[model samples]
Target: MENIWEVSPLHRQVKSEGEMTDLYKIEIRDLARAFCGALFLALPLHYTMEMWARARAIPSFMLVVILVAAYLLNVGYCYYSNFKGRPARQVPWLDALESLGVGIVASTITLLLIDQVNAHMSFDVIMSCIALESVPTSFGASLAKSQLSAGNKEDDLTDGWATDKKKILACLLGGLMFAFNVGATAEPIVIATSINYGQLIGIVVFSLLVSYLMVFMTAFEKEKEDEGAVMGPQWAETLICYSVSLLASAALLFMFGYLTPTTPHNLAIPWVVVLGYATTLGGSAGRLII
Candidate 1:
């Protein structure tokens, strides 16, 4: 009767009443940590390799239109899904792995696949940032869900529908993170192309991650999960996250392009220094400041 997508009853007992207030706080805290790790790893470890993905252009005009509709629709859907009293499930895998996969895919799409749309950005980098950002977010949100429960197994089956109002809101937030990121990243790429044909297969993967997060968060807790609405992390943590990203961007400038095959004059040079210095200012740094 148990499924991989459903969190076991044991895991639900992991948190106590005092934790309810921390649901949101935990989510924001983890988010900052994950992004920071990504920046530190991505900045210096693989910029040139990311740049090498020239996959070619394709028809994407229609696709662009669809994505725009989806972005708006999904944001609304996030709100709708929760209030509707839809079914919920649990899933395996820590939130970090989810985040890492997203970061890699976004990097790939931005560095290589976007060219498929005639070199136009079907989305803005912000969108990809959204997609990657949402991965672990679902897991973070779920902590709240799992910690708070409706009380007793006897009524959980039918009455659970009542929780939809709040659950749906959380779903919308998670979905918005994915849809916005996908559209935003693809927007710039799609604009360059006349048509918005299917994006590289990655969008599906991203969607799956988002969907998983919603159910995973819903079922992961045991004690009548509702903790996120209670507590929130300090803004200071958000600042640290942005700061780490800035440092990562600088590191990225130096580590990448050292081995590119471009011609001698065409090879990257002092541009690295300028980029190293410039990227830090507005890059992840801004995320922290805000």
Candidate 2:
């Protein structure tokens, strides 16, 4: 008693193959996005001398820890952000692994291209360099889910509901991204050393004004509504974020060995202010983007 309208096994097989093809295409597209994000944020680090030096000096155990931390970060980020541009899997380990792999691959290629690694280098050194570089790359790849998307909206209806804590975190992440480049370079120290107290004051004032304008003035009119204002008004938000950016700048500089107990506050404060300029802009932009 088979129905005349029954589908054939051949048709079901064709449908399955088509679905597989579509999934494959989605994977390829996500891979490209991950690669782009990795390079966009981490390329400057690849060129910085400090990163290379750190690679050689940091303990091998620490290098492995850094890589594992990056992978775990990717897992949490991908779970929340849908880095694949689709519903996240029940477990996001695959997405995290892919993100980590993209970072490692990008690091390897760029280090090789820049002559930071070669046959003459020891195996341990080479691995350490790649591992260290991949941390930022992997983080950037995770961020691509939210920041690099083409369909980000500007309407208040879409973003006005974000909590103050989320905004602050975004600012920190953004500040880190911008400061990462300058923190590792010698230019910030040089600028800090050359500038006078008056110039430093001017830089600090300018940084605050720029951060305010970037987050408030730059947004469209429709994007100003705030339904989640338990943390006070926009001005307070800007001040807090600006302060966070400065703190983050100092921390990053310390991590890069630019700040030490022997370094006088006279020099360290200016160094922070110099880098804070970039971090403030980044924090503001991050607030807007998120």
Candidate 3:
């Protein structure tokens, strides 16, 4: 479907004098939604101590990697999920790029207002922080369609593969939300636990098993008890969903400063696996809503 945020030629033809003003109004509304969505997700990370330290500590090359990854994810989401039913030509790549830009701008403005940036910091440091923080904010910005739209039409819904894809996206969002909530406060807990390899392995096994049961066995609604049966083969469905949750867990941990590039692989692996347990549960719960 053509982006609702975009003004079509038909809109421009409706009395020339007011056309520009109408278009401007639409653009303003889109920008406002984008900014609001970005802020909603970025604020927690903005205040995070680990995020601040990572911003200053991560190498320039890694900063570029994060920026590129964020951009690509935003673009893919825009194309496959956000603009799914729109005419391909109308869903311009520019919109995806622009959404990322909006996220970066919003993050920068927010950080500045919060006094996270000051003359004491070098220009590189400020940019690095803004860029690092923008990744999650950009993901939120790309979700503006679902995030901001309260009255989305029934026609926007999908079927078959698209439907499955939407579920996956929902899982990612749910996992991110759950992880962020705990991640903000869980660093101390993670440090205190510091489990051994055996315990870490147990956490990983428990996470997968619980996630599978949560999605398949727990009856959130009696009518939907068999919903998991329709997703695919039981094993494949569980594996795919669990993988998405694990990836989200790791990313959020890194983003929140629970995991860092400097940390040894052994330590980071266990932390991520342990946290993945919570995230997988959150992801399964997310699927239920969809």
Candidate 4:
């Protein structure tokens, strides 16, 4: 009697070695393509594509650039992880930088466009988002690392090449998704009296939700709901992250004409926008330094 050649959920038919190899190849190819496509499709509505259209570089051309760059970045990042002997929760160069770098780069380009055309926001707006970029991006990245590391298959623990690449891809996708959603939803409004309390509330809520979902989906989606995590950065270290923003906000309000320079405000531009970003992202980078 012979065994049946039926396909399993993982796609390899439960049969010969050649068939399994073939199936794995196809899966990797498809996954790469899927990742590339999602990378473009998920770019936040505010920047990149919106401005790319302005560049008139042709969409297909940009696609080529993204595919090539992403493939190389993926491969290179994976190589380092191989020597590091740790899960991607702590791969310093790519995971955190990949997202944080994109956020800052995107913000610069977007604000430049706004200044030339709209000129609606003050210097503080860009600074604030840049600062916030640190926190929100790091927070988002950390969430992904913690959540994903907790849920990964034990077999893949030392399989550095495959595991790290997937983790990096997840972080990139997470950042891209965050940008796209925020771009579509972000008000980017200028405040006259003080920061919009409502807007801050919304940012807080949205950042939490976005970070949670992305971390859950890209990295830790497979983990049990009640499982506790031992990987990723420690929670205590994040105080520096918050502190950077607090001090920055305090300074900005005093110096930048953001606050009355006399009466105390609940949130300062430095805190929310600049220091906030530094602390949030800064501390994460500190952890990444290891």
Model number with the top TM-score: 2
Q: Which ten residues in a row have the lowest lDDT in candidate 2?
A: 8-17
Q: What global local distance difference test value does model 1 have?
A: 0.31
Can you write out model 4's per-residue Cα lDDT over 1-290, one digit (the tens) per residue? 23121223445433332344444554344233323322243334334332322223223343334334443433333332311112422243444344444434544554465453235644544454333323232223223322223333332332444432333343333333233232222122133134565756554544334333433434534442322232334222223224333443343233223345455444344234422332233322222221
Q: What is the C-alpha lDDT of each candidate?
A: 0.31, 0.73, 0.67, 0.35
- Superposed model 2: Cα runs more than 4 Å off: 1-21, 57-82, 89-97, 145-149, 152-162, 220-222, 227-230
Best by lDDT: 2
The TM-score of candidate 3 is 0.73
Using lDDT as the yardstick, the better of models 2 and 4 is: 2
TM-score, every prediction: 0.23, 0.78, 0.73, 0.30
Candidate 4 stretches with Cα past 4 Å from truth are: 1-19, 23-28, 31-151, 155-186, 189-235, 241-290
Q: Is candidate 2 or candidate 4 better by TM-score?
A: 2
Q: Considering lDDT, where higher is better, how would the candidates rank from best to worst?
A: 2, 3, 4, 1
Worst-scoring 10-residue span by lDDT in model 4: 180-189
Count of clashes in candidate 1? 51
Clashes of each: 51, 0, 2, 13
- Writing each residue's lDDT as its tens digit, candidate 2 over 1-290 gives 23211333322322222453344455566778888888887888898888898778777876676677567756655544535654422136766888888989999999999899999999999998898888888877866756577633331222333677667767776777667777777888899899998999999999999887777776433466563565577678777888999998887776666787788988889999999999898888766664
lDDT of 1 by residue, 9-51 (tens): 4224223234432334434443454344344333331233222
Runs in model 1 lying further than 4 Å from the true structure: 1-93, 103-250, 254-269, 283-287
